[model samples]
Target: MQMHKNRPKNEKHSRTVMIRILTCIRPHTALVALSLLLSVITVVLTLYIPILTGHGVDQIIGKENVDFKELSAVIITILACIAVTSVCQWFMNHINNKITYRVVKDLRICAFNRLQVLPLSYVDSHSSGDLISRVITDIDQFSDGLLLGFTQLFTGVITIVGTILFMLSINPYITLVVVVLSPLSFLIANFISKRTFAMFKKQSEARGELTGFTNEMLGGIKVVQAFGHQDEAQEQFEEINRRLSGYSMRATFFSSITNPATRFMYSVIYAGVAIAGCFAVVRGMLTVGQLSSFLSYTSQYTKPFNDITGVITEFQNSLASAARVFELIDQPSIAEDKAGAVRLQNPEGHVTMEHVSFSYVPEVPLIENLNLEAGCGQRIAIVGPTGCGKTTLINLLMRFYDVNSGIITVDGQNITDITRHSLRAAYGMVLQETWLKAASIRDNIAYGRPNASEDDIIRAAKEAHAHSFIMRMPDGYDTVIAEGGSNLSQGQKQLLCIARVMLCLPPMLILDEATSSIDTMTEIRIQKAFEKMMEGRTSFVVAHRLSTIKSADMILVMDKGHIIEQGVHEELLKKGGFYARLYNSQFSAV
Candidate 1:
């Protein structure tokens, strides 16, 4: 039931998100500027047509001397302007779409790159599904809302201002009513918008939860099927789906109320305009043509308010998404590399933990001032009961988590003084849970050194005893592996992982229960490969199999995060310590 910790929260709404978003569009600023100019022209052209119509109506009704040719010219000019506006609108739409796509592309890349630079702890504490939702869903929402809302809001404001100014010039009294009603429109918009924003925030959170559930369920489908828990999973999924549906409905319902409520207020204002205008026309306070123009202007004025209100709603929704996006972007990054931090060059891979104390969380210390050291070219085996901090030691050595107290050094260089990238690059790791991408076997094997040639890949694979099996497959090295190497046997998968680590050819190697799941024959094959790979390299192996570490230069038996015994396998056995007891227990049973 652990939730993702990296989930975004709305802290404060600043122009910062928009500013950052606009920076990505700076390359397309020319196109954007042109689009904005065209949009303005379109609004102007749209407003002028009503004035032309009013003039034509006056000519026909009041003068009773319709200059048909002049009227035709006016109508044609209006039509021409309409055509121009349409063309401009089309171009604007194209530019906006292009800018939006580019911005989103940049945002995605930046977000992904930032994710890479973040520490392992960040990834460990977050769910892949929730992060995926932020990158895919939240960004998509921002893109959709931004493009539409920017254009509509700009044009709407211009139209509203232009119409109001024209109306005031013609009939100040009627304009007064519109000016009074505008504030009321804004008030209603603000009220509805607050509700919409809340609903949208809830909707976004629900979506992340739903996505996380999908990822977890799909990733563990094999386990679910093995346990015959499909129905139970379905029920759990259905419950999540129902909750998502309810939240979505609430958001939609609140959003739906905005348009109708705005329209209802506009309707009242429209009725008032009609009645007031009619009275003015009858009393000769306003001419028929003037009244007609005023009515047209009133409609134009209302349109922008309507448009603004709609944009406000969209803005609210986007703010919800932006809150999530910014939340991730603003997360306190892992300790950054300091200026002038020295690089560990030609590392000897002689690692030492000096009174290192650490914890994943504050309450529980996984490694308590644990002291250990591995000389260059020495093979160290760490054996312990499960959760006795064996793997945690490796994690610390790899600098995945900084120690709460004390220091870890590699080749006399404090790990904290070196860049994480540089420090990690010096080590090769083969984890117990081998992770293979859905790619060709050759690609998987050569993943550690992407530029490695076919010869290099084959050499590495051959050393791990994986080359023969790979060649015997349907497509040989080109055969595609399934996710997590599901198509291969566990032993074969482990061998491939070893081959990948071999390709890296680092001076330090970590093998975390790498041979635990393999058969005896495969284990023997890999054990030789590991011994060969560990040659002239500082190596740490965490294993339950006592035989694997019998030849290790040093063996440390750990219990409850403390190293209780240390020596060569025979030396520890002669000492009759914890290591001896564990070794005897297994051999005694056999």
Candidate 2:
């Protein structure tokens, strides 16, 4: 009952996905038309061969009656037709491959570009493995299905139509027998395909789930081993993998029924046509040569049905994968810059947040009515416990996430009114979670200022205290960083990130535990270098190590998303309030 109920919905979804896939092929309309034309030529030439063979048979009634001259001409003409058909089929396949791959390439580029503009929140909520599966694995499956459809579908239809016409001309009674039995094959195929589509959809989703689970475990394998949870992680992975296998088996089972079921019906049609044609020949209504041609036409007519039915599994999987891909590309992108939005130019490094309210989830409040100001060239330090909205504040300032109810401005201009590119360009940032591309150390340092001179890059590296370690490597400045910087120590990676920011020297700075990985001595040296860099730029530093921020022009003590206390180092210590207690707790041992 449930299977019957879902048939209409499944059919509708399949239709929609196919329509979208066709739109991708629209740019190659000329190729498609050419393919159709070639299909007609190929089918017509191939179908004509059987007629020539029948005629050749008629010419050789017996040894004494045989016409060798006519028989030789028919044989040559048959060979010519076969040769032309093969050439046309080859050309048709080449065009299909070209169109299919081009569409797949376009889809991949669109998905990747969509990722660039997707809001950070969406990335936070979706698993990276699932996204990767859609882009890579699913697209490859779609390409295979599309190529098969193009290769088989055009010629299949033409052959079926051409064979039916040729058969009707040969013997109407045998053709009628073939046509009557053909519908049963289609009915059987239709029933199985409807069920298979739903199964394949579930299978695709399970594959994505398994991918996400595997990715999560691998990314955190170190943590899992350190905590002695290898058994638990493996058990969870096995569970997801088992589920995926079950879905795949069920989808395959249903789809596999389609081909054999249709073939059985096609065999019956062939038997029926053969019997009817033999009776007609016995009744003097058909010739022996004509009966042979009718039999060949019957096989040709049913071959298309068998071929189309055989590809139903692949076609369903492709449609399922296409749905997932389209879903991602259609997701609402991040807000675009407003009309006539101004670009932030020569920013004065004065930033202000007024009455800002924000929450990652609506029911759970995080930050509320937050107000703060940083004067030009002032260094403001933000200190708070974990999950106390310290990073969220920085996100708001940089427009990574917009505030719900209030405005954040840079140099008195609302950040929302400024183009995000130019607004973010005004600040240099180094966060605790460092990111480095797989490129030379020189390129990593010059990431922010790609055109910076070699001397400038070396100076920034020296300032970040990374030059000495870099020089020891085999390629010095040209040493290529590995993917994820696995070849470098955590401290070395952080240093390169800092050097990147140093090279930029933007008007504003954000340091979120920027020096946390380095040892105390190097951190002290880097802090001194940071001081020189911040001499004339407003800097916002979020740190858990309170000792590093003592010289900040103003210190903000935050708790529960509000500023509980704000003062200079001397004044905050004298007051013995939240700021004093936090400061004392860190340096009390000293």
Candidate 3:
């Protein structure tokens, strides 16, 4: 996989970021509004308890005489409000969690769908591990921030605003002191928040790197052991782990500082409010009940500030995840089918490449103005050294990558003018690496045709000469193979792949070194099966074994992306050219 060396850094808190996030929530606006309403009720109930306590104190001091019935009603009303608020809080949390889950689900689906439409070049340039991290880990981080941090921030803001308004109505002098301390608290929070944001971004990036490293290591463990590089791999893992630890520590330390600084600032503000309240009480500027109420409001005002700071820290972490996700979503896709692109219907297997020029990268052409033609049902064999553009030829024929210059056609229709889905659906491919999922042998065979019946799967398997061996397994066709068919032999896996393509029954077929891994004996046994499978289909083979393609209708011997010779086996042998030399080398060994 190609590595992206320069991932962009998210340095500023842009209004655009907030706007994008809000756009994701557009579908869930109703739920968000309901949650906001519940948050309001929670804030109101939270502030009322302190006021009710102050009233009870006044009643006990005989300053505000209350009858038993009125006192009982007030107490019951306060308690009832608290209970309702608790219920509303639960309801809001449920809605928040639900919305977050749905949003993440939608985002993941969108990302995956976009991946499908993206070009093979794009996928080749991005690591599988990094892409997976963006889809899974980053989206989850966004969910966490939305569900926990956003909820707290909303409730805190409402509480702070409501408390300030009530405190001013009770006693203006005390409210003024509380208001002055707000900026100091904010300044401290702002400083810590910036540091936390930077650390958190690093921490998230480190996590993705670690995940990619671990995945690469585990996937190639056999290679590591065979090469005796286990220690090297271990050291690499240790380095990544240490880096992750350093970033985590920095993020945690900054996150930890925010709360304490907030608490200290709150303490200083409280001391000042207390001193001022005492003087006002002595001066008869405030009543005991009013002073007590004012003090409660002042302390509660800091609750919102603390809550906002905490939420801000969490939002910073979540933004890191969002940045990764957005990067993927914003990536340019391969050119799509044009406005009037038509689907190929019942395509003839005739294929032509005219003056084709192509490159995986600019300035390094893999194939240059190459021309070739294959009639319907013709078996074409391509022979070349490694990296001589044989596979690149197949990639272009399959439309996995478009040519830089020139045209490829199916039945006289330009492939570029056809829908990608329709173009690919016309061909069946058996790659060198036969990838089998963790599924039953029957299911694996039916993968090309999900709705195919049991009999159809059995027929395809039988045609590929896989049924006899599959029947010998403990569960026969029902036997489940490990991922990548680890439980099966290489020949067995190749046979399954052949069976899958046979099930698809496309008019055109590609065999990309498909039988290279199978033993000589298995190859001999399956040669007839392959011949039968190739019958009446336009077939293209990238040959590793010269004998396998000796019977091909046309053999194209290639060197350095150019066709050096093209003829039937006997005709090519008579020419004494590249094909003749290749045939002599393989048969000379025999």
Candidate 4:
């Protein structure tokens, strides 16, 4: 009952995806029209071959009275038609290939562009591997399906229609027999197509899950090995693999049934046509040559039905994959900047948050009614227990996630009133998780300030205490870093990240465990460099180490999303509150 009720919606969605796919082809209309013309020419010329064969046979009318001259003319015409048909078919296929690949290229670009504008929340909720599968694997499947449709589908339809017309002209009674049996083949194909589509859809989803799970496990394989969870991971992988295998088998099994079932009906149609034509010939209503032509038409008509049924499996799979790709392209993107929004210029670094409230999940409140103020050039440090919203606060200030209520302002102007690009441009940030591209050391340091000269890049590297080690490498500044910086040590990667921030030297700074990965001696040098850079900039430092922020102008101790304590480090210790307890515990542990 549920399946029957949902069928219309499923069909509607399939039609919508198909329409979108066609729109991508609209740009190449001239080529498509050419392909169509070729299909019509090809089908018409091929259909003429059967009539010529009948004429050639009629000319043979008993061996002694045979008209060899007429027979030779008919045979020559048939051969000429065959050659022309082959050429047109080749051109048609070439055009189809061109159109199919171009559409696939357009789809990939659209999906990738949509990914850039989509909100971070969407990315966070979906697996990276799953998204990759949609953009790459799904698009490839759609390409194959579309190419098959173009190459065979158009020619097949033309053949079917042309055969019916030719048969009617030859003998209406025999054409009736062929037409009646045609619906039986269609019914069989329709029933199987529905089942195959459902199965193929599930199979595509399972394939995505398998890709995601494999990516996740491989990315964290070191951790899995460290924790000795290889066995458990293997078990999980096998489970997903089995599910994918089952879905693929069922889909293939159902699609395979389509060809045989439809072929049986087509065979019945051919037999009916033959029996009817034989009777017509005996009644002197049709010539033996005409009966021969009618039989050839019957075969010609049924040939397309067989070819089309064979292509149904691929077409169904293509539609299923297109639905997935369109789903990604149709996702809601992040809201655009408000109209008349002003860009922050020469910001004074004065930041304030008043009665701000936010939570990742609505039911679970993380931060509520938070109020704080930082004066110009003040170095404010935030310390909190794990899951106490330390990072969430940074996210709010960066506008990566907006607050639920209240206002956050920079330079006495609401941040929301400021363009996100300009607001973010005013701040330099360094997080514990350092990211480096597959580029030279010089390029990595100059990422934030891409136009920085060679001298400036070197100066920034020296300030972050990374110049000495960088020079030791074979290529020095030109040394290329591997993806994810796996070729560099943890401390070296962190130093390069710090060098990036130093080069930018924005008006405000947000350092979240910025020096967590460095050695003690290098960290001391980096801190001095940080102090020099933060001299006139408002800096917000989030740290777990109690000693790093001792010289901070104000230290905020947060718990359960609220600022439970705020003062200079010395004053906070003297007050014997949450700050003192957290500080003392860390000192004692060391």
Query: Positional deviation of 79 in candidate 3, in angstroms?
Result: 1.3
RMSD of each: 3.8, 1.4, 3.4, 2.0
Compose the digit string of candidate 3's lDDT tens values, residues 240-285. Answer: 8899899889888888888999999898988899899999989999
- Per-residue accuracy of model 1 over 451-492 as CA lDDT, tens digit each: 999899999999988898998999999999988677899888
- lDDT of model 2 at position 210: 85
**Which regions in candidate 4 have their CA more than 4 angstroms from the true location?**
64-66, 287-289
Winner on TM-score (2 vs 4): 2
Off by over 4 Å in 1: 1-32, 62-66, 285-289, 482-489
Q: Which one is best on TM-score?
A: 2
Would you list the rank order by TM-score, best first? 2, 4, 3, 1
Candidate 4 deviation (Cα RMSD): 2.0
- Residue 120 in candidate 4 has what lDDT? 80
Pairs in steric clash, model 1 = none
Better of 1 and 3 by lDDT: 3
Off by over 4 Å in 2: 1-5
lDDT (CA) per prediction: 0.83, 0.91, 0.85, 0.91
lDDT of 2 at 168: 84
Candidate 2: tens digits of C-alpha lDDT, residues 1-590: 98778889889989999999989999999999999999999999988988888898899898699999999999999888988988998999999999999999999999999999999999899999999999988898899889889988778888888998888888777788887878898789888888888877888888888898888888788899999999998898888888888888988998888878888888898898888888898999988888888888888888899888877778999999899999889988999999989999999999999999999999998999999999999999999888889999999998999898999988899999999999999999999999999999999999988899999999999999999999999999999999889889999999999999999999999999999999999999999999998989999999999888899999999998999889888999999898888878987888
Residue 414, candidate 4: alpha-carbon lDDT: 94
> lDDT: which is higher, 3 or 4?
4
